[model samples]
Target: MAELARIQPSLWFDSDAREAMEYYVSVFPNSHIGSITEYPADSDEKHLSGMAGKILNGQFTLNGVDFVCIDGGPYFTFTEAISFVVLAKDQAELDDYWAKLSHVPEAEQCGWCKDRFGLSWQIIPENMGDLTRTPEQLQVVLGQKKIVIAELEAAGAGI
Candidate 1:
């Protein structure tokens, strides 16, 4: 809990919370896993014991945020309202991520997409995000639909 706030944000997803959490561990740098709870016998095997009720809590830290995944059901699913942004620092990084992340257009928004588990993410260059914080820079980000790494660099250098 003490270190959770240092980096990243925790997100909750119902069906694939567990699998997604583990996958994230492999995808990011300086990342490790944390505690998890299993479903009790009383519940259906299809439903991991603790997976029912008001909130199914699974605490996973990715890039160091106490990313709490909850099986809260379909009442809430991830949307553009909240998205995980991945900062790719270079063209190789961007292309690799774009290819892998945009495999499904149903879950893509320029450089943002949801994985098989319905977890939303933004795969953008790291420097792009840093530069896009200003008024003019922010426009560069919004001007395009998808994240073009070249454009990002151009935007960063104000070219």
Candidate 2:
């Protein structure tokens, strides 16, 4: 068995854990679906009655980070309070991630976007701090959905 990550972020899905896992692996490089444990068809527990064949625990890797997800019914959901950060090395990388992940237009703000799976992601440049050194640059960033590094640079240069 492969060694697991010391701390993996687990996602709770209503009934699309498998689909979400597959979608995520497709979005990021160096990603793949791992072990998947399904709920028993004959489960007697009331909470798991209709969960036959549903994912109990689905492990996956995305961009070298380990994560787990489950088809845990509609008792819980994803919130913007907890978001994953994708620090891109450059504008092209950032644009690619934003293009692929930004599905909920209403949820986008300040380089943060919500994916189709309802998960929030902050896709920003790795040197965001440096780019937004000035208040003007910071304001420019806050006004855009996607992080345009060149715009920030222009703002910082008083262009």
Candidate 3:
């Protein structure tokens, strides 16, 4: 099998590649927008009118993880199948991420939320694996939208 270049995730946007990159960089620590490629005004691409001077591609780093966003227009959209998991160190971190990342209230489930750009994310606790060592603990995790560390601990302890 061919090797992957660190498996950077690329997000497709209708015309908000730069916006998405900036938003992500603002939300995550140690993140930055690397480079941006704009579509040429004279390009013969199919969607010339909307593509001209738009961000064709944008490179960004979120919490040190590299990602890309493409302003490919409305041909494609994001789904829940693929998502980024923010492993928070504590409830405070999780709450911060949850506030910044959660935009679609209906999409909030089991610590997963869809942002304004329709991208799904899992803002989970770092100690989740250690706590969810049993079926009950796992159920506790599945029962809520935001993962509360205290609740997980309580459930794990059969409290």
lDDT by candidate, in order shown: 0.64, 0.94, 0.88
Model 3 Cα lDDT, one tens digit per residue, 1-159: 898657888889998888888898999889999999898875566557758777888899998898888888789999999998989999999999999999999999999999999999999988778988878888888888988888889877853
Task: Assess candidate 1 and give its TM-score to the true structure.
Answer: 0.66
lDDT of 2 by residue, 27-96 (tens): 9999999899999885788898999999999999999999999999999999999999999999999999
Clashing pairs in 1: 10-67, 39-48, 39-49, 39-50, 40-49
Model 2 bad stretches (over 4 Å):
1-5
Check candidate 2 and list the clashing pairs. Answer: none
Segments of candidate 1 deviating more than 4 angstroms: 1-10, 43-55, 129-146, 151-159
Q: Candidates' TM-scores? A: 0.66, 0.93, 0.91
Superposed by TM-score, candidate 1 places the C-alpha of residue 33 at a distance from the truth, in angstroms, of 2.0
RMSD, every candidate, angstroms: 5.1, 3.2, 2.3
lDDT computed for candidate 2: 0.94
Clashes of each: 5, 0, 0
List, residue by residue over 1-159, the lDDT tens digit for candidate 1.
566535536666666666776777777666666666654445666445555433355676666556766555456676677777877877688767666555457656557776666667788777664656556666666665457766656656743
Sort every candidate by TM-score, greatest first. Answer: 2, 3, 1
